[model samples]
Target chain A: MTSAPELVAIVPAGGAGTRLWPLSRRSRPKFLLDLLGTGRTLLQDTADRLAPLTGPDGLLVVTGTAHAAAVADQLPQLAGDGAANLLTEPSPRDSMAAIGLAAAVVEHRHGPTVVGSFAADHVVPEPGGFHDAVRTAVEAARAGYVTTIGIAATGPSTAFGYVRRGAPLEGVPGAYAVASFVEKPDEDTARGYLATGEYSWNAGMFVARTDVLLGHLTRHQPTLEAGLREIAAAWDTPAREEVLARVWPGLTKIAIDHAIAEPVAAEGGVAVVPGAFSWDDVGDWDALGGLLPADEAGAHTLAAATSAGDNGAARPTTAGPLLAIDSPDAVIASDGGAVAVLGLPGVVVVRTGDAVLVVHRDHAQRVKAVVDALAAGGRPDLL
Target chain B: MTSAPELVAIVPAGGAGTRLWPLSRRSRPKFLLDLLGTGRTLLQDTADRLAPLTGPDGLLVVTGTAHAAAVADQLPQLAGDGAANLLTEPSPRDSMAAIGLAAAVVEHRHGPTVVGSFAADHVVPEPGGFHDAVRTAVEAARAGYVTTIGIAATGPSTAFGYVRRGAPLEGVPGAYAVASFVEKPDEDTARGYLATGEYSWNAGMFVARTDVLLGHLTRHQPTLEAGLREIAAAWDTPAREEVLARVWPGLTKIAIDHAIAEPVAAEGGVAVVPGAFSWDDVGDWDALGGLLPADEAGAHTLAAATSAGDNGAARPTTAGPLLAIDSPDAVIASDGGAVAVLGLPGVVVVRTGDAVLVVHRDHAQRVKAVVDALAAGGRPDLL
Candidate 1:
């Protein structure tokens, strides 16, 4: 068979991740942090995972202007030739503008090639399965369908949306038409969806030909599509700044799922490839703790520049060691100094230079409420 | 009737307070910390309460040499007259040496004054009742009894010892003969003691004339009494350090209760003054939380140099405010930066410059185990 069409990976690197605060802040968000004590940050790991599928030079990163420098610093391999693959938005316009702009730029510069969008802050262990799924999704995308990689449901998790799958596509193996996309469900509904054995967790991974994605956007959201196209036309020229300054602000601020996937799926256009890789958004401290290996006491500690050995014991490479007593299931992180948790099980304690956060694992999601309260109290320095 | 025999307060300010770890360290113990957020440390508050009863020059503080400078810095008013009243020990020799040495020195300087030994870390709110109790104890001491102030039992607490009271003393009103002094008992014994109406919480507050106290020591442990007297002879001379180096190390390493109070009470030479005041040893974070009035959310925040008003709302005078959400009855203290607690009811969070401690109120006493573990792990910087 002839070589498959080249695919470019577009990463939308954003989100403050307030639910993981004290470790994740506005100035230093989750994507740029070595949150799991791995030597590489989440963004670097994402790039590492996608580089094999997209080739060495075929990756584009779209991020907010504030984080563009950090994103480039984190992924030096993507920073070649004036770092042309690094795209910066003046302000956040959600996933639609971020991904659409990258697709339009790829189409303008390299013709209509297949492209996949991945978040910069998700964790995927065991990348072989991910590679297989993305390859199948790219194959389906080349067949003129907007394809998405739906993660295998590890549990009946109410934290993630579900994607219902239809019959397998005629040509693409391991790929099926999308029946529907459901929002985050209640526990019972999620259990029902899991029991049906026809649904996968929506991990927000989408792949399509650049022309196919842009054409769908042009039909569904003409103003946003036109703005991205106009910016792309002048991207390589001196007129890029002028076009972006004028068109970027008025672009519709909508998510890609709403702008394209749902509407397109209703018309029998979307396809999904089942991804059998372990994945998590690391949405909160509890979620991050789930990805880490527990110590002998069944506690998890996340430190910078450390890793767990094959036997699941931490080999800490830095100071500020976590000392816990009678505190099982504790998730303790400190960039400041030693943190000692005594008799508080399932507790989350995080300490940075300027702030400290203590919460129960069950209340990890409510940490965003703390961020909101800080914002309301005019303590943006902490946020 | 005899002007209360000129009472002198002796504060044996020792104990590393490992249960209050991270805030109370070996070098900087709990007595020197402003744990109640009253703009004064427990040592200073103790001095403030006793200075009124003992007069400006009548209160003597005995602490370790490592904390002498910090103690002097906290209570500058006690540093007058060549700083003679601020006694510094060469090393810890337990309560007998600490209190007996101070009593001997008082007798050497002031000649047979009634000396009351109060812990420098205890908290006595509504000191009117405490003052009245001390006055009555002083009268009993003048009547040749080793008198102790017994706190009204608030609950069946197994954390403190119980003092059983006997028939009222013949002449000293509100002072009763001590039936016995019992060690910290099991839960059932403590509950039985509380139900008898004849037992009071042993607060470790003992008062007696310096001559009477030294006489009891001489009868019980003559070698300890002689060593203390030898040190007292050179206290005001250049020979003080020389004598301390020669004798202090060999002094009996015993508690005053075992050496004097228990035996003297068995002989009916000990008296009990019922103290109907709100008193706490401030033994752990839980005890401190009980003393401080809670805010509207039923949480307590203690900061350096800040005070809670009569209504119990904190009037913080600096930055780094303590913020909490859905955390009730939480005790948070910070000398570092802002601390936020979410959804952890009855949690105690303490942050110092080099260490942070998180524990539940129910397990506050177990913090000493954390300190022991840290010490075992060669983390002396944390201790």
Candidate 2:
């Protein structure tokens, strides 16, 4: 656990999560929400999972200015290390800048150490399997290979990208060279990938030496790297606000997958650590229903949205009462009021304080249409 | 129009409307609710329909003691005439006792006036045709026949009883001799009845000379008629409560159709006055949905339950807010909370203050199962 002297874990928290709208709002994003009805929010859960691997002062959280306070509020340990441990982007330039800023800042404060980027809103149910693969990924990262912990696929799910693994690295025992990173495939293509048994779900989890990441960024996204480096130079000082105000707005807006993982894997500089932990990005209500236990009616009910384990106070906003009859496989949620469902199997009901959403599980991905409709319908408060 | 010297209108208000549970409680029966989202409660609407025919002093409402205050509160014109106008039975003894008592009371007060008994919960839209039919029915009643207004059938509905006309009465124009009074028919039988062009929906709208109706009751249900006469004799006096308490529960519990109409029609003492008014019993959520206009999503949304037409102040109970998406033909009602439906066609959702129900339209009649389960499951408050 204490093998790497300067392996800092970085968390990139963002996204409006529009598909999970009415529950996931702009002011209260998904990362700060207990979507699974679990006692800990996704960010807090992410912090707990990495705390053992990163140690007390070795974890960093980079979020937008809007959610910075909430991110720190959920994970108070990030606050103890001062401004250096919690990086706030003035205006979101997407994942490339968010992660590069943290990597550059970590290198400035503690030299070019191996740093890992994990999303603040992913679900890794058990810590043991996650910890094991992360340890191997950290070893590969220390060995100067850009590494990622690829989740072992449970099905031919087309919602997430896939990573192909090749021959094992000479020095790193379990880490294999990542052959390529592919886009979200069609269902049949995903089936073919699964049949090959050489592909894992690309969970956007990347671990690499700070020097190696900065080196790849210099060769690929050079302008984005320079702006992040400028902000990192003044990050621990009073000049941080001034430099961030000047450089943050102009950083290249690209995901870490497109900027680093995909191209770096093609260049033989990336390694894949196969992770056997049960994982889900929780892309929609259908996915969320799959994660929850079914009740007597075979419907998944959302309990009071209280995070009991994270030392957070019980919120007044709750999932309220639900009476479901003959509605097998339906997901019913309410905001401090009673809801009833009958005969509508696989229906998704999301009743919040201001807006309510109802969609079939088969059309869960199309909830974005309702969000878009609300926006066009002069209901910005709902969005 | 006012040829008959004495024409009294009697309204029998009862029935918990178990199919519309939570909305129609023991305390707030279906007759007291403005279910169609219109400004008039069913009882108030019935009073208004009969008011023009009965005049100020000619209308009497026969309800149970439990609903006396609400009945008087809803129809203040009845309050103007004191306890005589608002007759409260000690207990429910079905339709025969309620109507027979009203008829007996009319004979005692007005000496065998033609009294018409109309149920408190049937919807007769456009009262022009209804008033015309009642006027003709009163004429037939004055001619010594136990006259009933038979509504023209809109479809082969199997929910209501049917009456077949034999031939036009020799004395009373537009009145026909009833050949038979049939119970609710099966779909094929109802379709056959509709094809005959002589069958009409038996809407429980009976108009008869109080003496003639009493005579029919004496022949068919003598004990019930004697008990009703005894109570009616003391109805306006201070001993009304005592007489009701003694005789009401002991009277035979039977529907008016079984007690007098069926047997009397078989004996050629009954006559049918054809009614062309649009009519509905609104027997269940599906029927109620048919009565309400569809919104953009083709769902019938229940509005605030305010009887604006009546002088009574609006009760706090309301159907609340609803956001429906892709839920065509859904019946969604709420008691002051937001409800949303998505992707379900013909679904019925009733969310009240204490309970909620969700059932598809095809299963509307089966809602009694949920009410039964709630009773069996120790949720009597919901029932």
Candidate 3:
């Protein structure tokens, strides 16, 4: 096994995650929430997963200015590294700028080391498979390809984009040259892609040498690249805030896929490393419900299993007891008080201190519309 | 339009209303709650409806000992009669004892006066129609018959029992002899009942001269009648508590319908006055939802309408603002913070400070099972 000591995991912790609203709010986003009832927040779990590969003090978290303090509080170990690993963006400028800035900063500090960007709100149940995929991707990255770990498409899921694998890499056994990156497909198309057995779900994870990622960005999104470089130059200095305030907002707002992966793949410079781990974005209550094991009543409670610590001791969150009667496949999440769901099959009930959200599983995606309505209704306090 | 000066209103306020769990509890039942978003509670509404017929001192409220204070607080005008009109039962001995004791007490206080017993938790929207029906019932009652107000059956609802009307009475113009009283029927039977215009919903509103109601009770339930008579003898005296404490528990636990109405109808001694007013028992959340007006989004907010006073001025309750997004036909009740329901049509969400209940409209009747489960689960605090 090759230990890539120079590799750093760059975690871009963003997204309002309105679909998980009342649980994932504006102030407490999904990344900061322990959604799985696994005692650790998604960000902490992401850090734990990458810890084996990156080693201690080798993880970088890029988050919004509003969430920087919360990110720091959830991850106290970053304090030992002078908290330099925690990067706070002045404001959201989309994925390209966020990841590019982190890449440029890592390159400046470590001199061309490999950096892997992972979302802080996803779940990978079996870290062994993830670590293996990351190792293969890192090797491909060292060989100069902007590599991504493609999650093995378990079903005909229309929620995620797909990456088509071309020919296998010559020296890298588990890595393959990427043919193309496709947008989220309809069910029929997703089924067709799954039938080919060569397409994998793009989980937005990218492993690449910092210079290579920045070079791809420079080639395609020059303005964003230049802005990220300027911010990186002042990142470790007293001029950090000043430079960020001047250049960050002007940076092009685009995802890393549009700016780098898709363009780089067109030039035959990207690779795909198949990941066999159980993975999910937990995009909505329905998705989250699928991840939780149901009790005897077939009700999924996002509390009981979540109250345990890493050592299996009780570490209860604010959620009270949940009672479900004759409600099969009900998903209940509460941080306020006891929730009782009766006779509603596949219903989703979420209770926070100030807000309560009730939705049916089929309508989980429409929760964003609720957040939008709240915004339009001038309830920013809720949003 | 002869005014029945000798008439008195006897309200028997009981029933835990378990189907409306988390809203109606053992201590605070449906009668005490402003369920319709009307400023007046069901009990208060009943009192208000009967006040014009029964003079200020003619309304007698019979309730369990636990709720006597709340009843007194809700209907303070009843205190003017030295609290003599408010009858507190030592414990629940079913509706028969509850109404029987009040009937005997009224007979004791005002000999042979007409007394109408109405449930404290029912709604009659058009009081003019109710007044006409009560007048007809009082005429039938003055003829020495046990008269009941049979609500005009709006639909083939299986939630309530049916009173089959026989031929019109000899002298009472709008009153007819009650052929029989049927139990809550199956859907097919209810549809058949609705087809026959002779059948009306038995709303359990009984009007009779106090002595006449007692005569029927004495013949049908002699022991219960004897116990209530014994209790009534000492009711307004110093020995009232002693007699109640000794005789209350020994009274037979039987509903007035089984003990009096059904048997009396079998003997051709019962009469029914067809009530044209809109009436509902508010038996479950679905029934309650029907009584509430929908907002612009087609969601029925039970709290918003309930907070207003009798004059239609906003008397806001403690409930925070409710937000419903795309959830048409949703009924939301909360005494807690804000409640948001999204994409769940015909859903019912109720929240109190200690508990939350989420159920579908079709499943609203099954809420009693939730309360039962809570009690079985040792969550009496929630019950």
Candidate 4:
């Protein structure tokens, strides 16, 4: 078999947010949590999946300073000399800054290689399909097209934005030109997109040569691109911290979707590689409950991390036994005590040391309102 | 106002069964708990409501050995010389033994005084109506009847047993001979009972002369009565522990309703004083949620006990904040963390030191299934 192309996987380890309150807090973001009750955390799982594609030294993680140490701890590959690739942002400047800085730094070290940006917190169950999608995207990247892996639409989900496919890329196999990028649509609009069979979910998995991404940024957002380049130049030098402090704070805070993806697609410079793989952002408790495995009783439990020395244990925040009764599809996690759910199907009960959250699956998104109430009620410590 | 007679309130501090698990454990029975957000525990509240009628040093308490210390701690009246009136059972022998033992002891100390057995765990928000019922019951008791306060049926609550009223008692006003005492009925039967105005809920508040209660016990359950009397004879003496060790375990584990109320009603020896006051057994979370006062948002929050030094606060078992959102009439409680309820109206989320319970009020009585599940799953410790 032929070897995979030279590509760096940039994982922006942020945004497991308020929608996953109590479990995913400001102190413990979603990427750092073992939300899937699997052997590894979301960040670790992302690293493991991308490791084969990027090779040992090609994986670079960019996370907030608050989560930097935790990222390093979870990823032993980042120990010693490998620590150089683990980038820590001084403060949050949105996704554009996080992904852009990592891309710029990779270019500074390895000169214009293919790098794909993947969120550290997203869930991609089977690595086989993901690897295939990434390889195709990387080939399109080598052909000088900014390629994004458009996840095959499982359903007309109104939660995610849709990317419409146009003509097949002339040079690259399994790659198509993007017609347009649309924001989250209403049910009717999303259903229409599905019927056309030309639409896929924009999962934000963009693969491109460092030069092409920076060149697009230069044309779209020149000032933001320059600051990222400055930060990357001094990233490995003794002036790293000082450069970040001065340049990072002033970087224009915008999502890469706004600064690059939408604009590049408009110019016919962006390509879509349809990813026929299960991918989820795990946006809210409802989405998360759907991702978790159900027991014989049909109860879905979010157990503790494998780091605790037990594969499927209690919550990482607290340790105890979990039990669900008459509560089918119950998403139960407790901070430090036993949890038992009863007589409620599709119940989501997450109890942390600081707070307990109870919501039904249908009302999962409404958990944001609860977090807002707590903040407005002057209990931000709970958030 | 006519002075309340020489009546002694025998508070049977027992029976908050598995339905109220976690909050009411074997070590901490329901009677010892402040299920209400009110500062005083059910036991303390029972004593407070009865103190005026019982007079100084006239109130007596009978509780299981495990909860004796907690009972004494909550009721300061049980301290010093008053400790004599606080009776402890070496082991639980059900309601009949508990009430009988207290009556025998009360008669031994105070010469067959009119004694009323009020459960420590029941809720009586208004003392006026409760006291009026007891006074009328006391008159019936003095006239040689085993009188139980019949609560005016608020609804067709199939959870409670019903007492059918007969002809009015000859000498006692507002008191009638019990036509029959029925067990918990089906919804159809309960509705039928409610249609007849003569039917009232059997609140289990039995008021009677100690001799009358003992006489019924002697006629029906002689062996159990004799054992209780023997235990009572040695109760306040040095041989108290020795006699309890011998007789307590052998006594019949039967409810007072079966031993006396049911049989005595057959012989026309049972009287029921109509008590038109709100009384709740606090049978399950549904009943509890109903008994608790609602806030402006219509959420009935069961806060920490007043003993916590904060009037309306978190769960008594925990120390933290509580928040309820779009979930109207949500009953949220936590053992030791802040609790938030979202979008589930009439939801009951109870997190305890050992386990968490989530159910809707519509399925509140079904919480017993959760407890049973825990027990079957080898988590009896949670129960």
Candidate 5:
């Protein structure tokens, strides 16, 4: 093996999966749920997918301090059977901070000829195809352009933002120049864009050389630029906490796409690799069925009663203590106690030891209301 | 006050409440659920409801051996704190055997003239109505006729059997001759019968001299007749188990309505007090809400969850440790480990330490299927 290209993997494992509730609690988020009961969690699966590409020592994960222990425990392949460079944030400041921090660490350690920012909570079924896209993007990143792995739009998914591809960049034949970044669009507009075949779901996976990413950030978001340099100077250096505390909260809470990637494209720089390896952010409850081997009629246990009426069985004559019963297309999770839903569709039920929650799944995007109410009521203990 | 009519309240606290599963188990049946948390179980509530009518010495309860302890625990008003004359069945025999045993004991101890049979699990909202009906039925029974309290039919309820009224019997003028008995009819036929205004719900509550009931049993169900006499011969006498074992299972599983009430009505001899009081067998989960305090949308709980829409101020939240968000018309009950029901309607979710059950209120009739499955799976340890 005569010197294969140096690979660096930046794993962003942060979001508190509130939409997947009950099972995905504040303490243990969705990446930890045994949705498939395959004895591996989502974050572990993501790490396994990237293991062959980066090898053990080259992978670094950035997460909040609250989840550091859990993230370390899940990624067992790390050096000394411990998490390799488990970067902990002082607080949740969103993806821009996480990616920038990861970039700084990778540049300092590996000289970042090519770095892959992979979401630890994503589900990529065809690992081979995902590897191919990562390989192609690595070639493009070597030519000094920031590359994002654009998932071929499967349907008009209004839940995710979209990226419109422009003409192919020079020297990278199959990759297209990024034209514009679209915020989550309405259903009809999403459908229209899907029909045109020039748009893809923003899978949040990005590839770039150290110089290209830092250059893009410096031009578009100077506030993040200063913070990234400060955090980088203190990397494995003392005063790390003091530096992070000064700059992390001061930066605007925005995704890297909005702050840096999209602006780089507008300034005629960013590129896209349209690949068909089947990817998902694993963002919500509805996304689980596609990622795992579900029972016929498509149901999985998130600690809820799963009755398959599609099997033509009479009233789901299954044997077991069913924690809760729900209508078709509903997601119910219980702690063997607090949350039980009956005749509900498109809803999520979550039960913690002290608090139980029931929310309409469609309105699941509004679950922050529950947290806000609890917090406003001076019950920080519940939050 | 003039001596109250001699009232003997023979409460039948038998039969497993399988329809209210998880919450209502073999160890803790529906009568034990603190549905209203009114400092009483259903058995306790039933006894309390009859407190004014039956003096301390007049209340007799009949339950199986397995549940005698539970029954005793619930009602403190019965003899020996409601345990005296608590006739436990030789085994898991049906209601007819339990009723016969009660009749034998009542006649042997309190004479044949005035005894009333009431079901242990029901919610009669108007105690005054129940009191009036009980008094009237007692007067009518003393006049040498069997008197069953009949609820005025509210609608065409296909769920319950109906009793047809005939001519008024002599001396008990408010009581009518029971012209006939009808099984649960088809919806259309039930509607036709209801329109005629000549039928009432056969609630299985009856007031009759013990001798009169025994006579009717002898004329109709001779197996019940033989069993009753054997039970009577061994009454308060020794060698209880030996005699009960020989006679109990031989008694048919026929209900009192089919064995005695129907036969007497066929002969145009029985009468019913036009009972203005309401009654429910409390037969299934759908029937439970009527007996409990329900909100405007008719939701109740051992534990329940309701939803708050975009305008959070519109939803009234729970007052305890549990939190419910944006759920409506669902019944949730928990001992404390957090039960949350999301978007659901007319359903029951119950959680106990060992088991959890979920079912639609309408399909609650099939909860016994789940129980049977649990039992058949050779987990009587759980059942």
Candidate 6:
């Protein structure tokens, strides 16, 4: 078929920024946030970072029903032609179903090409090095192997999953066959993993030939394979959407790492390419600050209207009407109402139209607590 | 004139909650605030506190032009017969002008009756004790003494002025003649003042014969006395509003403590009643927690709908939505935007709609630094 397309990119931009609340809500997810006002959203920035690697040819985006319009609106440059493929999920199944959905679509359209799955909410400052790492993973993927990119461990951060590097691949020097996959480890384990040079962060960036991914899924997860077949067979049929709606809700709520990569590594043939660029999930408010320019006090306000001088009057000096303030070391994002961080440190304050949230930054992972609370309170309207 | 009316209560209620920021705005000064949600405002409570002392008809309110309507709206009981005797300042001239103008009006109408000058913003919890103290001061005032009630110093609080208790007056047993008035002392001097039994807080609650206050002002500050006479002459005349408009703007912006109390004390003859009652200016957000019913965690909030349930998901399980979340030892307040506190001890976070202020609670007196910064930036609107 004229030598299947050289490179394929699949971006899943569907994470709700519960941690980044107030500034990010169900209507506005983290990927669409114009954090730092760099004139580009995290999704656009992710798309831009992968642009050179795919060579202006092939890129695809799969997002949830809520975020599809926003994804399409933000990256207008990828419009007109079929250069960007935007797909929508039928329901809120986890990343496994999302990846499966995108992989099936990519395989149907692009055939046996190499596919790179990237999260839309990440930032890789060094574009050229990231592009090179993706190229290396693509090279490994072409050699009949499923490849994943592992970021070099920066610190003993207990917040992310870890990948253990195995035997070196034949053609790629930096590429290693993944020894194993580990879930987010405890602090001591993370420190241990960091001390050993064999471990790197499981950045969720993966590259695999379309056929290889399908084969891995069929062998390891028969239910997912069956669902994919059912979805593909009824593709142009009226039952397509309904079948997905039926099947997706039943699929296991698991990450691609747990469903596919760990199982593949258990069989001992997966390869890993160490990423060359600086990468962060932009996971919390602290992560957002690392990307911004700060003053001598180490305070970084997301409310751009607030700077040193405005902190005194507790008013915004900027014309945008500062809706938030002097919450040193806290991340405050406001949409309708103003939020001020008085003497608050290491906290997240969010002010939406009807709901306002104040939480400790470290406990942000538990913001699902608020979501659960909202649901139990029978206020799905808030969610 | 039938021995004159016994007393005229000068209720000073002119301050905007500027230092308290967002919550305490131009429209909602500290006096108008429902701080403890007793359903009575600070001003109404102040008026109610004085009601028993001054038999049904001895109250007058002096407030700014913007807040006159709110003052009248809240204190309707005090204005049962007349127009509330609500005197409006064309603009904020300072406490000296407000007090002087009130003194002039009281003198003209009530002749030489004892004038009990009470702050609309202070909270005296023990009404019985406060009335007894007022009675003692009125007795002193009728004897031609400018009687000031001095609070027993609780701690080394640099936020308030200090009064050194001198020898006792001949007839006033529990009262002491004034030695001198000290400006807000430094921390060291405040500690020294707290250590000695001879010093007390300049509670700003004074009882004086109308003629005694006017005479003291006329002797110590002739310019301000002239301005007061001009403002008084304008009353009940066609040229009254016009002359007050011309004269008040040019009057020296000074606190009565500095322009009159200090000089009067230096000249001797002022008497101090050892007043016993819980008192607070309810100065900032940090101060609100003490005024209101704190939650189990000693947290206070000002939201329309608040439910602190352990089982609620939308709200925090451990800590709730705090307008200003001052930590274990920190103090923070806001007008109503989102405010948070983290990792800070003994700090004060204040969020004004116009500005955000963060300072240690002990250093709250330095809020002027924020005001100064706003002024330096040419932002008079915030100031």
Order of quality (TM-score)? 1, 4, 3, 2, 5, 6
lDDT of 1 at B286: 90
lDDT of 1 by residue, B1-383 (tens): 12323887888888889988887888868887778876777888898898779887777889888888777777776677778779999999999899999898888876888999999898888788999999999999999999999999888888888899999999999999999999999999999998889999888899998899999998999999999999999998999989989988888899989999999998999999988889888889998888777887789887753223332233345547688788999998887588999999899998877778999999998888888888888888888
Best model number under TM-score: 1
What are the clash counts of all predictions, listed in order? Answer: 0, 0, 3, 3, 13, 20
User: A201-252, model 2: which lDDT tens digit per residue?
Assistant: 9998899999999999999999988988898999888898888888888888
Q: B1-383 in candidate 3: lDDT tens per residue?
A: 12335678989888889988788889888888888776778888988899888877779999888888888878888786479789998888888898899888877766778998898999888899999999999999999889999988888888889999999999999999999999999989999998889999988899998888899988999999999999998998999989988899899999999999999889999999998889889999999999889999999987632223443233457666687877899999987578999878888999877678898989898998888888887777777
- Relative to the unseen true structure, what is the C-alpha lDDT of residue B203 in candidate 5, on a scale of 0 to 100? 80
- B264-320 per-residue lDDT for model 5 (tens digits): 878765778777867676677667755666654446665421121232111233434
Kindly list the per-residue Cα lDDT of model 3 for residues A1-383, writing each as its tens digit.
Answer: 12435689999999888899978888878888888887788888998999999999788999998888878877877766488889998888888888899889888776788999999999988899999999999999999999999998879988899999999998999999999999999999999999999999999999999889998888898888898899998998999988988888898999999999999999999999998888999999999999888988998888632223544333576555687887899999887578989878899998877778898899898888888888887779888
DockQ each: 0.78, 0.36, 0.69, 0.70, 0.33, 0.23
lDDT: worst 10-residue window of model 6 chain A: A305-314
* Segments in model 1 whose C-alpha atoms lie over 4 Å from true places: A1-5, A305-317, B1-5, B305-319
TM-score, per-candidate, Cα-based: 0.94, 0.89, 0.93, 0.93, 0.87, 0.86
Candidate 5's C-alpha runs over 4 A off are A1-5, A79-84, A238-254, A290-298, A302-383, B1-5, B79-82, B219-227, B296-298, B304-328, B354-359, B372-383
Q: Stretches of candidate 4 above 4 Å error?
A: A1-5, A80-82, A306-321, B1-5, B80-82, B305-319
Across B1-383, the per-residue lDDT of candidate 2 in tens digits comes to 12334678889988878888767877788899888766678898888888889887788889988889888888888875466578887778898988898888878876878999998998887999999999999899888888899999989998889999999998778899999999999999999999999999999999999889999888888999999999988887889778878888899999989998999999998999988789888889999999888998788988646233236534655333565677789888765555656676787777665555677889888777666666666656666
Q: By descending DockQ, how would the candidates be arranged?
A: 1, 4, 3, 2, 5, 6
Interface RMSD, in order shown: 0.8, 3.4, 1.3, 1.5, 4.4, 5.7
Model 3 chain B: weakest 10-residue lDDT segment is: B305-314
Each prediction's whole-model lDDT (CA): 0.86, 0.82, 0.86, 0.82, 0.69, 0.70
TM-score of the first chain in candidate 5 relative to the native first chain: 0.82
lDDT value, candidate 3, whole model: 0.86
Q: Write the per-residue lDDT of candidate 5 for residues A145-249, one digit (tens) a residue.
A: 788989887789898889899998788877888898899999999999999899998888889887788878887787787788788778666687788887777
Per-residue CA lDDT of model 1 for A20-96, tens digit only, reads 99778888788877788777778888888998898888889999988887777777666777888899999999999
